[model samples]
Target: MQDRAEETRRAVLQAAAHLFFERGYAATSINDISERSGRTSGAIYFHYTNKEQLALAVVEAHFAAWPALVAHHEAALEPTLRKLVRLSFAVARAFRDDVLVRAGARLWAERRSIAVEMPPPFVDWIATVERMLTQARVEGDLAPHAEPSRDAPTLVAAFFGLHTLSDALDDRVLIEDRLADLWLLLLPGLQSCPAPRALLAEVGAAPRARRAAPTP
Candidate 1:
């Protein structure tokens, strides 16, 4: 019974996530989830009390699987700056690849209630990358900073800049390709500087001369 219940829950989340991604959360109804999951509306309610609750479940799954995604992008690297860049691309790719995740994020943001205890997964994702930037700074991979740790926010800002800018182009692959250049633009004035070989190999590989576009 537990196994069946668990399977049903997973199915519901997967379906809801897809709908939320494609349709946007406010547009996604429980009826939509029901049809997508091949389960009845009662089954969905049986598993999750409401669509809001179901959205949370989808986010939980995204967070729980996050470490593995990080590992996949970073695994082959020898802890170089490129690996970090690859991880950034990996994250963007993950979000981009799964419309459900995108829709779910949209839904959550729309339904955003102060009453909910869940910290935004997007915020948490930024925090995780900030930790990485903090560590890299400590190791002298970034530019000099009075407080290298404080520079974590910059890392998040840079990624957001890249994501928003790249996404606007509608060709995220191109943005992923130019991540190294993006890092260079953002890394200046930081406390530690990563080695050029590492940076070039991992973070600075764009051959096309990029013209600066206005930040969104």
Candidate 2:
């Protein structure tokens, strides 16, 4: 009975996340989640009191998985600068590919309408980046003018701005490519000489070979 209930809850969360990602908070109704989950309204309501609660659950589940995602991608193995770059790519990939993360991001964007007093995942992201930037500064990887306190939020803002633009264009499938371009623009100011190409390779950022000119 407990296993069945847990399975039903997971199904509801999965369905709600998909609906929330596709329809946004205001447009996604509880009945919509129930229909998609293949569960009755009673089952959904047994777990969540309302749509707001369900949406928050989706967001919470998404954020809860992030640390494991980072570790799985080996973000901890690299130095701070490389770790930051790798994490940026990992997050971009997640936003592009993961439905739960997509739902969480959308929910946070619509938090004002939802009116729930939950913790924003962006705060944790910014804090993590700030710590990495500070570590990079201490290790002399950052430029003399680089200020971790200012740049950490700037970096996070730029990342989400890319996501917003990608959403507007309806082509988030290429977010990883966009993040690569962003890292190219950001690395010069953020890293010292050499830019740690070794660490970059671990994150799959190795530069492509130059193509030969086509014979006329």
Candidate 3:
């Protein structure tokens, strides 16, 4: 019974995430979630109580996913700067591909409409970037002028702005390419050392090979 209940809850959350991604908070209803989940209204109410609570759950789940992503990279032996760059790419991929992340982003953008207080967006992200930048500085990889305290928020804002623009223009299919462009432009200003060619290639920012000199 417990396992079945857990399964039902997962189903409901997945359904809610899809609806929220497709339709903003005000447009999505408990009935819509029920229809999508194929679970009765009473069953949803038994678990979620109301649309507001369900929205909050979906948003919370979205935030919950980040730590594991960070942990996975942290376990890898890499420079802090490289980890930060790769982490941004990983998050961009999630924004492009994960329904829950899309729902959470939309819900966050539309949080004012939701009656219940939702967790503030971007604060944790900024903090994470700041920590990574500070570590990069300690590792002597950050440019001398780069101040983590000042730069972290800027980096986070640009990263999300790229996603927002990509989503608006092309439903985020171009997000990874946009991110690569951003890094190619910003790396020189942020790093004291040249970013590894492998790292640049990983995010698709690698420079093109020079054309062979024309035979005389």
Candidate 4:
């Protein structure tokens, strides 16, 4: 009975994520989710009290699954900057393929409608980038003048803009190319020593080997 209940909950979240991604939160309805999942209204209400709660669930699920996706590619020890670059590619691929991610991205714009204050994805992302930048500074991967505290937010905002453009254009490859171009443009000023041209070239290359598996 417990397993069956869990399955029902998963099905509702999956259906809701897809609906929310295709149509913004205000446009989606409880009936829409129910219809998509082939579950009764009672089943969805069992897991989520309302559409707002369901939308929050989708965002929570998106972030909850992200660490595993990053960890999958980060198993081997590598240069800090290289790791950061690889993670960006992995995230882009995930954004392209994962409906949960798309839902979360869509939900971010509609967060004002959500009653509860959920964990903000932008804050989480900035913190993650800050940690990576701090460590890179410690390891002398970054230039002497490059301050992680200042650069972290900048990088996060820039990447967010790039990702937003990708979503608008519906061309993930273009964002990947733009990110590689961004690295090439910034690395010279950011790296302690001359940035590896090869690293810039390699961004969005073969690193999809650890492509994130879609969350069920």
For TM-score, candidate 2 versus 3, the one ahead is: 3
Which number leads on lDDT?
Answer: 3
Candidate 3, residues 47-143: lDDT per residue as tens digits?
9989999999999999998999988876678888888888888998999999999999899888889988888889998999999999999999999
* 3 or 4, greater by TM-score: 3
In angstroms, give how far residue 19 of model 3 lies from its true place: 0.8
Q: Order the candidates by lDDT, highest first — what do you get?
A: 3, 2, 4, 1
Q: What is the C-alpha lDDT of each candidate?
A: 0.66, 0.82, 0.88, 0.80
Considering summed lDDT, which 10 consecutive residues are worst modelled in model 1?
189-198
lDDT (Cα) of model 1? 0.66
All candidates' TM-scores? 0.74, 0.86, 0.91, 0.87
Write candidate 1's Cα lDDT for 1-216 as tens digits. Answer: 999999998888888888876776678889988999999999999988887788777766666667787666546645534566667766777767765556555555665541344545456656666666666655656555534346556677777667667766874667655566665565454425434434545444544555899899
TM-score of 1: 0.74
Off by over 4 Å in 4: 72-75, 171-173, 202-216
Consecutive 10-residue window with the lowest summed lDDT within model 3: 202-211
**Candidate 2: residue pairs that collide:** none
